[model samples]
Target chain A: MDLHLGRITWFQGGRDKVAREEVKSLEVYETGPTLTFSMGPQHPGTGHFRMVITVVGDIVVRCDPDPGFVHRGEEKMCEYKTWITNIPHLERPAILDAAGMTYPYVLAVERLMGVEPPERAKYLRVIMAELQRICSHLYWLGLMGVFAGHATMYMWCFGDREYLVDLTQLIGGQRITHSYFVPGGVRNDAPSKVPRELVKNFRTYYRMMLGKDYPSGEVPEDFRKYVLAVCDFFDTRLDEYYPMLLDSPIFIYRTKGIGVLKREDAISLGVVGPVLRGSGVKSDTRIDEPYDAYPYIKFNVPTMDGCDSYSRMMVGYYEMKESVRIIKQAVEQMPEGPVKLKQHPVTIKVPAGEVFASAEAARGQCSFYIRSDGTDKPYRVKICSPSFRNLIAMPYLIKDVRIADIPIIYWSLNYWPVECDR
Target chain B: MSLSKAEEILKRLIEDLRSRFGDRVLEVNVEPKKIVKILVALECIKDVAQYLKSEWAIDYIKGVTGVDLSKLPNNAQEALEIIYHVGSLSSEALKGITISLSTKVSISNPVMPSLTGIWKGAEMHEREVYEMLGVSFEGHPDLRRLLLPEFWSDGPPLRKNYMVPGREGQSG
Candidate 1:
């Protein structure tokens, strides 16, 4: 409802309206009275990205986002590596959401190669993907807290994110860049050794302290309880974030009406993920075309009508809750089976065909198009990253706000620079 | 997914295009995935794009892709293939489907009309195609190098003919 349309009018040093009207061109002002400067590929706000902004008085008149600082020619590089060997570097662009990044690529390869992972592998993949979604949203929220001038929110978010990170390390066998996905299935099934060890160690400690051994087995009271408990703890923990950031007066004042992208503008620019959902669009790849275990497990795609920075942030905030619900369901309903169909040789040749695979990533929609020409190496692989698709929305929104509010609007889109340049 | 669900949507759309332009629509392919492919001649690509946007309501694009077809075995035709995968945001029935419209241009002078006039989101994608594959869009507003550095001019790196530096004779 609130549409500033890229000309914010409030400023401490307001130039006379009649005098400002005479200077019609932003380019003229750039050459004359306006200040034109390039912000960072190094500026903490625009990580690995630069933007040239021209401002007249306190209002921005023109913006040019330059985002090739982290370009590594990822698609070109994929041509050289075999399909299985490409997973590690393919996910490097979005290391925080590695599972979400490579899910579609692996699915696409599986579709082309005509192989299906076992049923349990599908559930495991969904659990890891949703866990990483919550992890990724928390990282974004922590950085956004700092951008909103609230260090406490930053500390709270990063601290809580560790629980999910630890849970992920238990299954994924790594901390951050988990190349856990393979063509037919995941790299390995969920490990019982780590959790069994933890439960066994806890049983010994409880007997020594309380003088009772109680009951124990090979499964050791099941690992599913631990995953469910984390989900329950996070359910209440995420509720706290809503009031701390969303309901607080100072936080709302900074983000509520800033960078309002109207519904029409959002659709025309082809924005995806939270940026589009925040603007009242009922579209998500997971719901529209259910992938992995999403077809079985039920979840909601949260939508907001505010069409502002606050709406985008709230959509991401609420999506984490849905992700938690999904993780709980996947763990409970998982079937017992082998993870992979069969072990193929290192050099697997896919039949000549083309496939397009898409997944709902933490940031938004990420898709991969693979064209195989009956060879181990692919003829082409095109990555359509959500950050790159959302790039147009930045210059469109940043044209009207004050210089101080730029970081608030920029971080609200949750645009990661490395992902965009890839 | 049930393949027929996607196929049902693909059938109606392909029928509409075939009826409208008889000879211009060259090829139609339905893969096992949730995608529909239509290959049109080079000249009618703009008309097909305009028709899809105005009549069929395939509003937003996923991405644009280009493939060099020079190095394929037993292939004599020299050309660069371009593909545009489109979907709808407003229409729920058509949300999951992707219709990739492809067109080919001569490898020597690969110039085609840009679709940015209709879908403004393709501006950066067109620039990227220009930078990576040397396939220029004639009517594109800002057709410059997007991700490539300013000074590099060896060749379009994505093209099959352009060998990566220090990796010559290292064919897989």
Candidate 2:
């Protein structure tokens, strides 16, 4: 009769024993023709994650989300590597939002080393972070569409995301896992010049977004204008998704009132980012704890009162636009200076101290608690990933829902296995 | 940037903690301005956690981390430090204040009371701590290996004593 009764054993050798024990505990297990099977990693709906749910007459009664399929022991690995080398491995956890993943770690290490990065480096960090947020949200949007059976929405999102991914490659020198951030500052500075032909194609749009009237011949080398043009384009392009997916009848029917997380429950469970915002809370680590240029940058924390799958979808959707706004503001306000510290990042040994820094990643707040022992390496690096925190809410939300409605509920929580397991 | 507003809350938080906890609160260290670390006794961890949740509106725990000071190049005492990174979401006054409610326990019998009752979100985090650090949370409902495989019988991997496989000869 209790929710927190016992551990759900991974159905291995003694399948019948697991089923029988489950039968004794749950009414669904006791009922006629009950099904006890894992919606495992191989499934399209569940991305390298599993939820062993027990069902009776199409209603899921018990859900035990089994993650850790991609467990690489990321934190353990951090101890062995130098602070500079840890970036590559740490960023791998959440590759989609690599800058966001490693930002807090870099911040902690920077504090430990007692070397503040330049003002330009800080602004560049903000720009890269927002770009990564846009890319991650696009990837998520594509997945949400496919899960809801809107194939066109998936195609459109994936295709459009490539543009941002290219922009990432241009800056970070990598597409997915950009190990661009270091303890001192960034590994490299964002490009100073933009391609002539690229901007020439969208010259009018660039002019309007940048608010300059020059009879274009040479296609201004202003990378800020190029970035702002892309941001403005995305800000306008986001409106198209409303008609394509949000306003659709099937999308509304599936998500409008489904997977409704209450405001109280959201706070108590410690869910972050869009899921928290979707439930009517404006608690963003970017706003709460201003890191890098977040304090200087002006943007709104979007909150939705719907508190359902649709609201979560809307929250993430609006966040993409807000991210664009942050990028534009950061790009325009960025000053000229050296991006990295004068001291070599590789040679620096941190003093003995403990510090924790958290940043608002694409999904939620990704935090790092670093305890350095006056050495090149860390004593303990505790990574509190948002996916891991959000994973606890799976069983709480997945209960008492139809088996068909499982994917929508699970995806709405934004649980990525690698990030959660790492 | 409202950080000053958050600082006022932190000062009040420290004052309230001292008034309530007294000598049980061993130390209170604020890293720069945002993070507050409070060291307390192992026996009163659950009570202190409950008090923080109810009184300070610090309902959610960001994480539960266990650090083995036994392996550190420190002085006499051998102990495992359990740090609970708690923060607020319900009350705006307490927002952005990252409170580390930490306690030290003997390494041989690394056990502490679970805060899952106080913060239900701590269930998985406590489980991870149990598996990784071998620190038993006495009242944890389901204390099984979370991220680790079932075959992992070797002592908790995160401890400094247990050398990570290939990292033995490396400069860690």
Candidate 3:
């Protein structure tokens, strides 16, 4: 009756021939009713990822998430590149929020170099990062809607996301991989006319699209007023968003109690971002370890005790509002100065030291452990991405769930394959 | 918990470890703003980990980072250092503190006790360390390659000595 009474050498190959033969002799070989199938690496539901699942009838009994389809050896490749050049490719893992992905890396390098950015540059970094967070969350929201078979939701979310993307382009000159974040600060400052342009665009958009007149032109000297006005405009748009998606009967029915992860399980599994917050753990790196302009901003860390797909989705929705608030505050309080330090990017030398820096990215806590050996390039770079940690919970959450709920639960966890595999 | 309270708890934890572990605890370096790094003998790592879990309530492991020290000229023993970044969500006092428990094993005999029994979250990270750094984690339930292909016959890619196919000219 004791399972561990004897060593199971059946998997040891030819060396365990006797044990293998004994196992074959004792067993009655009969095919089980369970169906085993490999879903993805090319499937529509899973993006460039594969998971082998064994199911009985419609319920999944076992699941194994096989990532690494997009592994480009980013960590190892960092050793060959200079401190500054690595920023562009390092953000590729989670391109939707490029600034968020590279923020921690820049922080770690700065710590090693013993230099701090100017106050203006810090606020600029915060603005760029918050914008990236909104863009990334919108992208995930669209994907979530698509996974649940709501194409209109996808169109709306993606369509709304372009405005933020345009703003990012106006500042960084690139839409996706901005390469905007550097060691001492961001690459450049916002143009002098950006505040007026933003205010005008938001007012025009609100009046034309939402049929609501946004009061503007008050306190034009403060960029924060315009940013807050835009955020207020989005607050109105979000009111239209809830009843259409979260309150829909189908959406509620499909995600209400499905793939429930308890708070303990979520913490032990190392899940982060909205998934961790949804399970009622009040842990966000942005709040816990205030970095950039996070300390100056005031916003509530949204949490839900439901621990279900719906709760996670709601967390994502509420977080977008909080990001808007943070951006507005950061813009309002930002001091005027040079956006970047006068240090040269290519020839910078960092002293021999190691530091680990973490930031709350859209998916979760993105951390970078960089070890420098008094050189321009790093000795070793270790990236612990949120998607990789959250992937550990997939096998546990997928158990006993219907096969149809697989994509819903999967996307709800926000497991970005590229980030995980990196 | 406030920063000062977290530091007090960390100091008390270190003192308790010193009393309990005696000479087995090699070094305890506390960086109040960063992390608390503790190096222990390979033989006493499991006991130290158990004490941290049961006594200090540092339950969850944030990550398991393995560094291959075989390439270093001074490390003639050719050791592999594994640092376990363990913390807790259940305990409010210990939430702010991250205890980094590290142990080193000779590369020729790279075997260490797995912490999966203590923290189930360490499963995937241990598998990754096993495959990437070639450290055999004893008592790990499923010690297979987590990221690499099954048919991968090359030496552990993360090891400093493992040369990439066409990039021999570049030095680390």
DockQ of 1: 0.33
Each candidate's DockQ score against the native complex? 0.33, 0.42, 0.42
Ranking by TM-score: 3, 2, 1
Tens-place lDDT per residue, model 1, A1-422, is 01321232211122223113322321133467888887787899989988878898988988878788999989988888888888999999999999989999999999897777889999999999999999999998889889998888898888778768877888888877889989888888886544556545544544543365533323244568767766876787798898898888888999998999988888888889999999999888988888778899989999999999999999999999999999999999999889887776768888888898899888899999888888888889999999999998988999889998889999999999999999
True contacts kept of each: 0.41, 0.44, 0.29
Q: Which residue window of length 10 is worst by lDDT in model 1 chain B?
A: B144-153
lDDT of 3 by residue, A202-247 (tens): 5566677677565543424344455565567666777777988888
> What's the TM for model 1?
0.90
Which regions of candidate 1 deviate over 4 angstroms?
Answer: A1-30, A193-221, B1-5
User: What lDDT is reached at residue A355 by model 1?
Assistant: 90
**Model no. 3, DockQ:** 0.42
Please count the clashing residue pairs in each candidate, in the order shown: 0, 0, 1
Docking class of 1: acceptable
Model 3 stretches astray by more than 4 angstroms: A1-31, A195-208, A212-226, B72-77
- TM-score, each model? 0.90, 0.91, 0.91
Off by over 4 Å in 2: A1-33, A196-221, A343-345, B1-5
Query: Higher DockQ: candidate 1 or 2?
Result: 2
